[model samples]
Target: MKVAMWSGPRNLSTAMMYSFAQRADFAVLDEPFYGPYLRLTGLDHPMRSEVLGDRRKDAIEVEQSLMDPVPDGKPHAYHKHMCQHMIDGIPRSFMAECVNVFLIRHPARVVASFAKGYPDLTADDIGFDAQAELFDHVRSLGQTPVVIDSADIRDDPEGMLRGLCETIGLEFDPAMLSWPVGPKPYDGVWAPHWYTSLHATTGFAGPEGPLPDLNGHLAELVARTMPAYRALETKKISQSMKL
Candidate 1:
């Protein structure tokens, strides 16, 4: 089975990737299209030159890699993807063969965390709008894509993960709750710029309290993304499980 887990920046996407990587049955792929994304958008992210030099920069080639059989004969493949990377021209049809999952975080928290590294962030940079669009697109294709909020996972890792596993037709493995401290073979080249906090941990951290206020452009970006975030929240697995 192949699982395409889509998420925006500063979410628990990497930690989730680590969780799945702990499972012996899964092979994790970290942000495979990130290099191509930077190349296409001309975004001068940290380590841009190194990322472009080391990773594949063709979207079509990357998409083909995702469609191929699991690496090293693993039974399942867990692909950690950033929604913003799906920029113009990348084909979306491969999604039909994967069990797509959306990993989301509250807009306030996302903006607050994101702005620390990317001071010039816009709503598009955070990827909430892109995520909502992909969610609707997957649904329109008759697929009930799974959505999980980062807060829910941090609050109840076992329960949320077990529920997520079941929803995606996989058995919940206790290993998904923890992983070794430090990097793995699958981390993207931009890990140093974005994964500092994650690299120091072994598992999901506790939920953060009230986020600080957003002002100026950060505030505007949050306002723009809230609608999309809220729309996707209505379909999150935690909320749906209650009904």
Candidate 2:
């Protein structure tokens, strides 16, 4: 199976990728579209030059790679993607070929965490709108993409992962519960700039704390994103669901 996980920045996306990388049968691909996104947007994100230097900047080549065979002869491939990177220029046809899942988090949590590194954050920078649109796109393709929340996973990694596996017709492997502290070979070149807190932990953090208080631009961002978050939240795999 090829699992394409779509998510925004600071939405527990890296940790989730680490979890799947620990699975023996899985070959993981990190942010294949990063180079293309940086090239197209010219946003000057942290380590922009290095990111552009690391790989093919063509969306065509990157999308082709996503559909190609998993490396190392693995039985499955897990592609970690940033929702924001699915720009108008990137093709959506390949999504129908894989099982797409949307990973989400509370807007306040996302804003609180993402704003530190990207102080001049915008709604598009967080990718909530794109995530929702992609969700609809997948649905339009006759696939009911699974949606999972970061807080739910952190609250009970084993139970949530087990349930996620079952929902997707995959066996629940105990190995997905944790990973070694620090980076894995599959991490993207941008890992250093984005994965500092994640690199220190072997497992998901505890359940998310109270929604952070926000004001000014940050508060406005959450407000704008909440509708999309809530829309997907209604369709999420809840803790009360089968496990």
Considering every candidate listed, which one attains the maximal TM-score?
2
Compared with the true structure, what per-residue lDDT tens digits does model 1 show for residues 150-203? 999988888899889888888899999988888777888888888978989988
TM-scores for the candidates? 0.96, 0.98
Best by lDDT: 2
Residue runs of model 1 more than 4 Å from their true location after superposition? 239-243
Residues 131-183 of candidate 2 have per-residue lDDT tens digits of: 99999999999999999999999999999999899999899999998899887
